[model samples]
Target: MTGPVVVGVDGSSACMAAAWWAAREAVDRHAPLHLVHSWTSQPLDVPISQDAHSERLYGREVLRRTEAELLHRHGDLAVTTDLVAAPAAQALLARGGDAELLVLGSRGHGSVAGFLLGSTALRVVGLTRCPAVVVRADDPTVGAGRDRLVAADRDEVVVGVPEPGPAAEALLEFAFATADAHGDLLRAVTVVPGSPGPRAEEERRAWLAAELAPWREKYPKVTVAERVAVGPAAQLLLTSCGRSRLLIVGRRPHPSHLVWKLGPVAHAAVRHAACPVAVVPHG
Candidate 1:
């Protein structure tokens, strides 16, 4: 949390929404907000005319306008802007290396469809060392009229708790910290593969409680609820998002020889969750 919160801006409604979200998060963390826009020259192989100078100007304008709007909404917030001459994904990664968090917006196809993450956002989320949050552009909660920057009293921060290990520990650390920051309830959920008997169910619940004990001690003021369900992990987590202000899931680094990939649960949550989703890489 040493650096400012960085958000990618492309002059789209989606990026604007993400900028707003990032502003609130920055305020909560007592950090600055940085808006970044990247532009690149067209490949020589393409026949279409492309003006690198014009594109650079447009990128600067986008950053300036976005910075103005965010400062308007959050007058006291420390805001900065950058125009990078590189591809979107590359620029974001380089800027986000020391950031507290990287925020991006995902477009929704329609009411029935979930998020449609663009290539830049997907790649950044997969590879970023810091936590990446994907905010839906069409989220009703985000807008100019919203007066409250903090989460509601009843809102909860839901985190998908994987098997007990380093990954789960990292995920819960973020979830508890966020919930404590906003004074929201923390809900930790785990979904097993198959239906279990009464004894097994009891055992699972006990295990979940044991897993959360240390976190509870660490954040004694933060209230926590543990839930254990039997079903697909992604579906259950997505269902929980309706009541959650933020949904968190964990992603493990891919093998050295292969490209980084988002695990099944993290991928599904970012794509379909009703609330803003944070993907944290651990282990």
Candidate 2:
């Protein structure tokens, strides 16, 4: 981690939740917290409105109040606030330059004012230079849902490893670290394309175990659960991920693509998963 954890704020409930989540992440990573609110004085197509100045001032006030509340809750944590004069997504992308990780709400109240992560967040996450974690609107608070995995007594980190190759190394490492940090179990899953025979299932199980062997030794405290399901990747993950604290998936970094490069499974997880989704870019 090279820089602070940057979270986008828009005075919406979702944005506040994301900020709270980012604060906890900053604590975990031992990094500073930056609360940012991006605003544009001039609209892309329309001319500047008479109330543009007041709107900008309101953005600053939102940042100020958000900063204060976070400080009140975490007095010892180093925090900073910024008001960027750029489009929401553009400002966030620029801020990510100095961020170790960027956190945002999955969806916001709207695009004009509240930090709605809907389109802007998707755009930022698609083109982000740093890893972006999307916190759902209804995510449970730290005091309420930190370790609350559905139907499970202990928290479990679920990672979707599409393949047992280098592409998944980053995903596995993140999952293992997260699980170890929470003293939880790590569940590594790979969804096959179609129904698998008993022999194929056995082979996949073996392969999953082999791929995760080194990770298991590296984090002895982390219990590793391996699974190979036969079905569409997205469906399998959405079905099994309900019992995990966090669902992590990998994306191939392709700056030249000019569009979001998340595969089907990752895209689905982000859109539907019940827990926080971390999209780790790997080679």
The total of clashing pairs for model 2 equals: 3
- Segments of candidate 1 deviating more than 4 angstroms: 41-49, 109-117, 144-154, 193-195
Candidate 1 local distance difference test against the native: 0.77
Please give, for residues 33-55, the per-residue lDDT of candidate 2 as tens digits: 99888766322332345687877
Per-candidate Cα lDDT values, in order, are: 0.77, 0.73
* Worst lDDT 10-window in candidate 2: 141-150
The candidate that achieves the highest TM-score relative to the unseen native structure:
1
Off by more than 4 A, model 2: 41-49, 108-117, 141-154, 193-195, 255-257
Question: In candidate 1, what are the lDDT values of residues 1-283, reduced to their tens digit?
Answer: 4689998877766777788889988988889998887656222222333777787877788788888877887899999888877777777778778998998876653221111135546777888888998887776446543475434533789999988798889999999988988778899998664667777778878888988998899999899988888888899887776668799999997766136667888888877887788999888
